[model samples]
Target: MFPLSLLFGFYFVQFSSAFFGTGGIFGHVLRYQKLCLCRCGVSGVTQFPDSFSNVRLLDGQSVSPHQFPWLASIKIDNRTIAGALISDKHVLTAASPLYGIPPNRVSVTLGLHDGCTRNPALSSSIETVILHSAYVSGYSYNDIALLRLRHVVPFSQFISPICMPDFRTLESDQVASTLSWKWAPNSVSCTPRVATLPILPVWTCLLNRNSDTITPNKGCLGPLGIKSIVCEDDVGAPVMSRQPYSSSFRLVGVVTTANCDHTSAPYYTKVAYHAAWIYEQIRDDCQCFSI
Candidate 1:
C-alpha cells in the first residue's frame, strides 16, 4: 500500500506538469519534492486552535487572536482588502477591488488583528501584482490575483501560509468557513470575525438570480436566514475548509460578491477550477500536500 501511494504521488507530480506548464519533467518533480519536504511541510499550522467549538449556525463571531495566521490585510491607498497568505512571498486575493489600482501603491500586512495599529515589522511592500489573464474590469468572472511580496515572510506562531489544496479535495456542499475583518463602530480598529458556511451548487446559486451571470468557475455559499455569513468586508477573503482530523485548513475559494442582506447567495472564484493557473504562477515556491 505504501509503495502504491508513493508511486501514485510520483505520477501525480508528473501528470500535473502537463496541465500546469511547470516545464522540464525531471526538474519539476525534483522541485516539487523539495518544496513538499522543506518549504511547506508545515503550511496551515496555527498557534490558536479552532475546533469551531459550539459555533452558532446563524451568526458569525469574533475569533481569538492569531486564530487565523494566513489572513492578510492588503492596504491599497486608504482602503483595505482581505487576502490569504499562500506562501512566504505570495498572497492570494480577489482582483475586482484592485482592478484599477497600481501595484506600487499596495502593501500587505500579516499577523494582523487590529487594523488601526499596524505593526511596521509585520508589513511588506508588494513587488508585483499578477491578475488572472482572463479577468476583466467590472466583471466577476476570473476575479483572482496574486501579490508577490518584496520580502519573504518568516513563519511563526503568529504568521503562516494556508495550504493550497489539490483539486480532489474540492467537493460540493462541503462545510467551509471564512474569516473577515470589519471596522469597529468607532472606526478605530478592525475586528476579525469567522463564520461557518456550506458550499452550494451552481444551479442552486442561479435559482433566484440570473442564470446568465453564474459562471462555471464560480461557486456559491450561504443565504443563512436574514443575516449573512459574508459581507462587503469579505469580498477578498478566502473560503477555507478544515482538513478532516487535521488542524490545517485548505483555501477553497476567493470571495467576489457577497450579499450581506442574504437576499441572494454569495459568490467566489473557485480555486479548484483555477488550480492549474495558481500552480503555474507560484511554481517557484509551490508545495503540494495530500488533501
Candidate 2:
C-alpha cells in the first residue's frame, strides 16, 4: 500500500510540475496526495459524493461532472463506447466493440462528462488491444478486453482510475450499478447516466435464459422494466459496486450485452472470474488497494 501511495505521489508531482507549476497547485497536489493516503483508497477517489442510488442508465438521471472519474469513452470507427479506467495506462472494456476494429482506429477519452465532443487534451491513442484469448465473437463469454494507452494518464479532479474488485471478497447479492452515456433526445450531445442493477444468482440466470449460451463467467443484472430502452453505446461500460463502508467503487463487471427491453437482463463479463487474466496483464503497473 505504501508503494501504491508513492506511485500516485510521484505521478502527481510529475504532472503538476509539468502543467501546473511548482507553487500553488503543486502544494495542493501534495496535500491531496496525503489526504488520499490517509483517508481515501488510492484508486477510487472522486471529486464529488455518490448520489447515484436507485438511478437507471436509460431511464435514470444524469451524473454530475467528475462523479465517476474512472468512466472513459472509447471512440472507434466513428462510434463511441463506454469503458472504465483501471490503471494509469489501461482501460477495461468489452471486446465486442473492437471485434474487427484495429487499434489504430481506436482512441480513448478520459475526464469526460459529455459524449458528443472529443476533448483533445484528454484523449489518447491505443498502443495495443489485449482481448481475452478465450473471447469469442457474437458471444458474451470471455467478453473483456484491455486497451493499453500510448501515454500515461494524469489523475486529477475529473480523471482517475477505478479499483479492481478482489474476487475472493465478492458476494452474490451485493448491490451493483451500471454507468453509461446516451444521446439526449433531439440534441447533438450525450450525457453520462447511471442506474441501479442488482446482481442475480448464476443459477437463476441459467434457468431463465439460454442455458447453453450463458456461462458462469458472466453475471446477470436487471429486469429492464417496460420503460427501459436499449443502450447500444453501453456495450463496454462498467458494472460497479460500492465498497462497503467506504466511498470507493470497484469494478465488478464489464458489460457485454445491454438491452433495456422488458424481460431483458444485460449480461456482463464477471471481473471476479477473470481476475487472473486481468491481473496477469496489469500486475506490473496496477495494484488493487483493498479498503
Candidate 3:
C-alpha cells in the first residue's frame, strides 16, 4: 500500500494549489498524469441502472414533460440554472451557478413539465432563495446550496421526498461479515487458498462539519471518507433514496458539482450528514404553501 502520509500530502498539495485557481494545474496533473493517490474508497450496496429517466432527454422531444415529478428549473434574472425539489420547502443545487447573484434576482419555477422548451411565462415562480453561508466560487468542496420556497408544495405520489440512509446502521467490513479464518500453528501452508467472500463496504451519510460557523468565501469539502455521487448538470438536482414506509422516496443527498462529467464519477452532498442543518434552514426561511 502507498504511504498514507504521502497520499495525504499529495491530496493537500493538489487541493491547496487548485484552490488558488492556478489554471487548474493540479487538476490536470491528477486527471492526466495518473497519480496513484489514495482516495477513501467507499464500497457499499447500491446498483447503477442502465439509464436514468431523470437526467436523460427524450428522443424527438426537446423537453421531457413530467419526466421527473419533483424536478424544477431555477432562473436568475432570465438566465436559467438547473435545480430540483428535494422536499416540500427545499430546492437543492450547486453554489457556483449562483455565486454573485443577489437573492431578489433569483426565482425558482416549480410544477414545470418542460423547462427546456417552455416559455418563461408558463412556469410558477418561487418566493426566495436561501444560499448556504459557506458557498464559494471556483472550488467545489461544499458545493451544495438550498432554496427555500415561499410556499410549501403539497405531498403527492408523483412529488414526494426521498429517504436517507442511517449512519448508525453502517458497519465496517469485519463487523458486517460474521466469518473467521484460521491457519495451522505448526504447519507451513504452501498452496494458496482464495476465499470467495463477498464484502460490501459500509456507506455512512454525513453533513457539512461546520455549517453554522461557515464563511461566504469558504466551503468545506467533506469530513472525508464517504462515497459521493457527483454529476454534471446535477448542479441543482436532488439525491434521493427509496423508502419502505411507503412508495415514496426520502431526500438523502443534494446535487453539488459538475466537475464529474458523463465520463467521470459524480459527487453529492450526503443528506443524512446535514439533516439538522437542512431542517434548520427550512424552518427559518420557508413558509408552507398549498399546491
Candidate 4:
C-alpha cells in the first residue's frame, strides 16, 4: 500500500490542477494514473441505506430533513464515495478525504438508488468539485468542500436543494438546547404548588476547542457531545436543521473529522463560524445558484 501521506500529496497535486486550471507534471501524472477522471460503478447504489434501519446496508431511509435523491454519491475514477447535495451544483463532503484534490477530476453522481445497476439515463453528473481553500488535514476547521456540476439540477421531490441556515441568528445556547434537550416541561407543572425547575441538559463534547493547538479556523470544531454529531462514512457531509415552522433546511455544521475507531468522539466544523466563507466560495465558484 502507498504511504498515506504520499497518497494525500498525490491527490492534492491532481486536485489542484484540475480545479485551478493549472497544468504540469502533477497533472500529467494524474492523467496517466487516470485519477483525473472517474465513473460510477454498478455497485455504488448499495452504498445508500435507510437512516432508521439497524442493518448498516439496508437500514430505514435517509432522514426526512435530508430526504432528497440528489443529495448523494461521490465519484472518483471508478470508485464512488458517499456525498450529499446541498445546492443545484454543490455536493458537500468531508474535507480530509478530498483536501488538495482537483474539482474536474472528481465527478458527483446524483439521483441514483443503487450501485448494482447502471442507468445513465436516470443519473446526473456534476461539473466540478470545489474543495474549501482553507481545509487542513487532521483539523476539523474547513473540513467541507462543494462539488459544482456543469448543469443545474432541476428541483423535484427526489432532487432538490437544502435550505442553508442563517448563521447570523444562530446562538451557542440554542445549539446546546437543540442537541441536548429531550422533552419540554409540562404546561401544568408551573401552576402546581410544588413544581420542579426544568432540568438544564448536559451535552457530550463533540469537538474540543482546547484539545488541539490549532487555532479555531473556518471549519474547526469546539467542544461538543457525541450525540451532537456522530461519525459517518461521508466526511464533509453537512449537518442541516429545520425547525417546525421552517420552510427549508439550513446548514448548522459539517463533518470535519472523526476517529470512529477511537470510540471517544467525533468532531464537526461549526457552520455558523464559517457561514460567510461558505457563501463566498459558493458565490465565486458556483454558477447554478445565487448566494
Q: Quote model 2's TM-score.
A: 0.78
Clashes of each: 0, 2, 15, 40
Q: Of the candidates numbered 2 and 4, which has the greater lDDT value?
A: 2
Model 2 CA lDDT for position 159: 78
lDDT (10s digit) by residue, model 2, range 209-245:
6788688788877553442332656788888887656
TM-score of each: 0.80, 0.78, 0.48, 0.55
Ranking the candidates on lDDT from highest down gives 1, 2, 4, 3
**238-282 per-residue lDDT for model 1 (tens digits):** 888866655567888999987665567778898888887877777
Top candidate on TM-score is: 1
1-291 per-residue lDDT for model 3 (tens digits) = 566766675566555554744335553444211122322111121332333223221111122333344555677785555555655666766677777776777777654543334433224445655566665567655666777666666644334333333543221231111000111222211211111111122232113232433323222222133332232433555544332333333444454542322322234455566655555555322121111
- Quote the lDDT for 228 in model 4: 23
**Where in model 3 is the C-alpha error above 4 Å?**
1-67, 116-127, 154-231, 243-246, 259-263, 284-291
Overall lDDT per candidate, in order of appearance: 0.73, 0.71, 0.42, 0.43
Model 1: per-residue Cα lDDT at residue 145: 95
TM-score of model 3 (CA atoms): 0.48
Q: Give lDDT tens digits, candidate 4, residues 1-291.
A: 445665675576556756754345543444322121111111113333433222111111223222344345566665455555555556666667766566655676565543445333234555656667776676665666767767766645445554455534342333311110011122111110100011111232413434453334333322333322233443544444434444344555555554433334335566666656555555433212112
Q: Could you tell which candidate, 1 or 4, scores higher by TM-score?
A: 1
Candidate whose lDDT is highest: 1
